[model samples]
Target chain A: MENQEEHQAEGVGRPGRPGRPGSNPEAVTARIRARFGDASVRDGNAVGCESVIAERDALLPFMTFLRDDPELTFDYLADVTAVDRLKLDEAVRFAVVYQLYSYKHNRRFSVSIPVPEADPRIQSVVSVWPGANWLEREVYDMYGIVFEGHPDLRRILMPDDFGSYPLRKDYPLHGKGERDNFVF
Target chain B: MGLEDQLQENVMTTKVDAMVGWARKNSLWPMPFGTACCAIELMATLASRFDLARFGAEAIRFSPRQSDLLVVSGRVSIKMMPVLKKIYDQMPEPKWVISMGACASSGGVFNTYTLVQGVDQYIPVDVYIPGCPPRPENVIQALMKIQEKVAQAKAN
Candidate 1:
């Protein structure tokens, strides 16, 4: 019991430690191992979640595989959001995260794709998930990332004439005096 | 009891301006442009608990053309400013605006990009009710103040 308590204190758990009740982490981990190798997959630090870091070029193909493969079908595109990691001391300045879920398997996984600061552009996944339309537009509106080939790509939250992306680290919390010029 | 006798008995001496002012003050139709938590308190003021009808301003009209008083009772975001201004413009002449709450009068706690500093910058305001979410009593008092202003209006 003391040794078990020490292990808990050290924050050490066995490989493939069970996650949330409904989620079958073992199944997701096994499939990721068989397909993308162990290097591509990691325990997401968050319990009940697993992380898969996919290459930019392989993003669409991997997402397609995850959706089509019967054993690891992550059919639900829960959300598409981005994090502005400008001051986090990371090589890739932006990280676009895709939260996915498998209704059939009753499991969930998160895929994060690191994007660089310069020429931030990514392939539009609307063809794969129609729901990604507005979500991607919102990401673009906030992060200023271009989702190439996004049909009707426009600002969803901010005004069309709004210049700066509000969510970026460089943008001011009080705004850039643009809101003052608005004629009511 | 001929026409000459009836005219002397029925005629009463009163100023035309005073009569007009009396009508304006007693029959103020309010437009409640409530958008936040203050809206709930505004509703309470209108409800039986506070009974706003006693002031003769209980007729809550959503259409700006039908209302003479705009009871702005919450934070007004920048995006919402244009709409608020348009509604104010649509209100008939001699209309008064009551900014009810900290957010409405001075942007309250949300001194941020999305919120306007104060609604008065966008539209003319008559009464500024000071409170985070002013109690129903405060709303009643503001209404009384508007009634005073209406009573003092001059006829052209």
Candidate 2:
């Protein structure tokens, strides 16, 4: 117990200790809205936890600000993924979701950006978080969402020659002959 | 007459085919291609309590070239089909394959896209042990069945 106390005092083991200096999710969302203006941040709400919807064009800059701002310091990109909503009658068919965590504040939040079906393109968040590389690739591989400006983006899970995105709402549950053709 | 008769019976003989069959049936080195839960059961069969060594098949060689029996004990996915076929092809002739589980035998409950419907679709299987994960004794029974097949095989 003494050794643990010494480590905590030095800030070596527990960076995400509750008393550390950082803003809560609500403060982070308000700051983003203030800096980027109302046009950039479409909506902000607390559904189970705080979630912010950002415009597709302002995504990269907004993410950069969130990481660089000392008060926010959302330094950890927990996950990068996408949801396919083909069944819903909405203008945008895909929503790219980013889960972020602040090590200093011990808080977590989500950011979602909707992308249209015809042009399912979104700016990659690899610049802010290097760990977004494979996560973004997985999203692309599963949902067929194109992440612009991403280096070395390709299929991360499925076979390179896999015909269609299997996670889409339109894809058949059992598959459409992809598993049978490869004999060798 | 015991000592006198035993001493006189010095030139006993047997058929060549029977001797060959006995030899082949006794020494079957198994290559365990274990990939899932069934692998644990296979290990139990090889352990001291179950004693697979008694059947002369405890020599678990990993290399396909050195092994005579291929015991595939898990679900085979579509991605793994080519690799499995290649290994089966590399094995020498007079080899036998045992598809040992519900998954390998008929794809079990994973009737989906990723897994192969059955291993027998790509490779010929001699014995199909039926269980989610067959017990160690059931594995031994399968071995005995294989031995019967070896004994009955015509001499080449």
Candidate 3:
């Protein structure tokens, strides 16, 4: 126990430790709304967590601000994924989600961008977070969402020759005969 | 008349086919193509507790050319099917295949687009052992069945 206390004392002010400076959900939402205007950002209905829905056009700039700002230093890009809301019958067909973590504050934030089915394209955040390369590629492979300006964008999980995105709502539970047509 | 009746004193004789079959059945080098949980059971069978060496099949060879029996034990996905076929093709002739476990034999419960329904669609299987992951005893029984087949083949 003495060793643990000594370790904690030595580890103070480092990333991931408790009792460091942090930002609340309301503060984060207010800052984003102030910068992007109330029309571009709004509070999301995510229970027990901080989530904000940003317009497709404002995603790149918003992500940059969230990372570069001193108070909201969301430096870590935890994950990039998408949801197919076909059954929900929402105005937008897909919602690309980004999970971010601020090491200074040791808090988490979620940002989502609604994408229409006709275009199905969004600005790539790889410039701000280089780790989004594979995560964006995975989203593209599964949900067929195109990430503009992403380097070396290609299928990451499925085979290279696979035709359709399997995670799409329209895709059948069983594959469309891809498994049966092997050359061997 | 038996060959013993025709043989002279202090001499022994037997058919060449019977001798070859007996030799092949006694010493089977198995190449394990294990890919999932079934592989754990396969390891148990090879360890001292089950001791697969008792059946003269403990010479587990990694090289396809050096082995005669291919024990495919686990799920085979669509992406892995081509690779599995290549391995099976590399094995020399007079080879036999034992598809161990439900997944290897009939794709088990994973009836998905990614997983192959059965490996036999690509390769000829001589024996199919049932069970999600067959017990070590089941593997021994399958080995005995393969030996029976080998001994009876061309012995008439």
Candidate 4:
């Protein structure tokens, strides 16, 4: 499908999306600014606006709006990944990445939320995106990030009895002391 | 057909048989369900230096339909056992399988809960190339053995 047709197909998309009568990137920018205002918005080179490096409280609402928004039409959540930011700044220690695909607009947006180390609780978007079930389980297994409403959250890649979160920054990379050593 | 008909056809009377026969004779395609590092050596055997294309086995088809041989390389995991069975089931009849490397031939070093001890636990293996990781020359020799097996079957 053509790019613009996708968003219109979603419902009524923002003016910034292609082929919309009044849509422009600036207009979408205005709509975004109007919703969460100046403080919540930050730009990233990799993805688009709606990038909302959202706070923990802001996650569920923003995700809900993105799902319900006719103009933005971010109907599909493609992937969710966790990045442990322990050394970068303890202020917000982990990044929960949500990749949203707009079927109507043939466009994509990524929503990142930063969770501080003290209280690493974030709402599960599984209610919003069915596919987030496995993705959230992976994040929970690897980063130990607590998803508040996940029904069947458990360790995935590693064994159930495995003690620690392996992907976290502090987890030793030596791989359980099995490394081969060569004589100097 | 009958054994008498098969014996007479083994005689090369046509020019087409010599040219195409050389290809059908030497070029035996290998399809490996490589689940680990031993797969790298399998690729090396078909690379430019070894040049398995000369023997007409270089075309590595991913699907079982066109493949003449199945090379079960590396350690087969338990989760992967069903997938291997599915792939093996998809292959045309009269297919041969080579159990390449110790992992596929036996269990090799990864004697863990997840890995299947050997591919032969699920499917018949025609030749077993026993090594931590066999060299390309060993792969070529293994192929020659399969070819001899094919020739013997034709005689029978």
Of the candidates shown, which would achieve the greatest lDDT relative to the real structure? 3
After superposing candidate 3 on the true structure, give the runs of residues whose Cα lies further than 4 Å from its correct spot.
A1-23, B1-12, B154-156
lDDT of 1 by residue, A123-144 (tens): 8888888899999999999999
TM-score of chain A of each: 0.82, 0.83, 0.86, 0.77
User: What's the lDDT for residue A28 in model 1?
Assistant: 61
DockQ of each: 0.55, 0.45, 0.63, 0.05
Clashing pairs in 3: none
The alpha-carbon lDDT assigned to residue B39 of candidate 1 equals 92
Cand. 3 TM to true fold: 0.86
TM-score for each of the candidates: 0.86, 0.84, 0.86, 0.54
**Cα deviation of B99, candidate 2, in Å:** 1.2
Model 1 gets an lDDT of 0.83
Tens-place lDDT per residue, model 3, B1-156, is: 866777756676767788888999999999999999988999999999999999999999999989889999999988888888888889987889999999999889998778888899999999999998999999999999999988776744
lDDT of each: 0.83, 0.82, 0.86, 0.73
**Clashing residue pair totals per candidate (backbone < 3 A):** 0, 0, 0, 13
By summed lDDT, which 10 consecutive residues of candidate 1 chain B come out lowest? Answer: B1-10
DockQ preference between candidates 2 and 3, better one: 3
* Candidate 1, residue B24: lDDT: 89
Retained true contacts (fraction), each candidate: 0.44, 0.33, 0.70, 0.00
lDDT-best of 1 and 4: 1
Alpha-carbon RMSD to native, per candidate = 6.4, 5.6, 5.2, 11.1
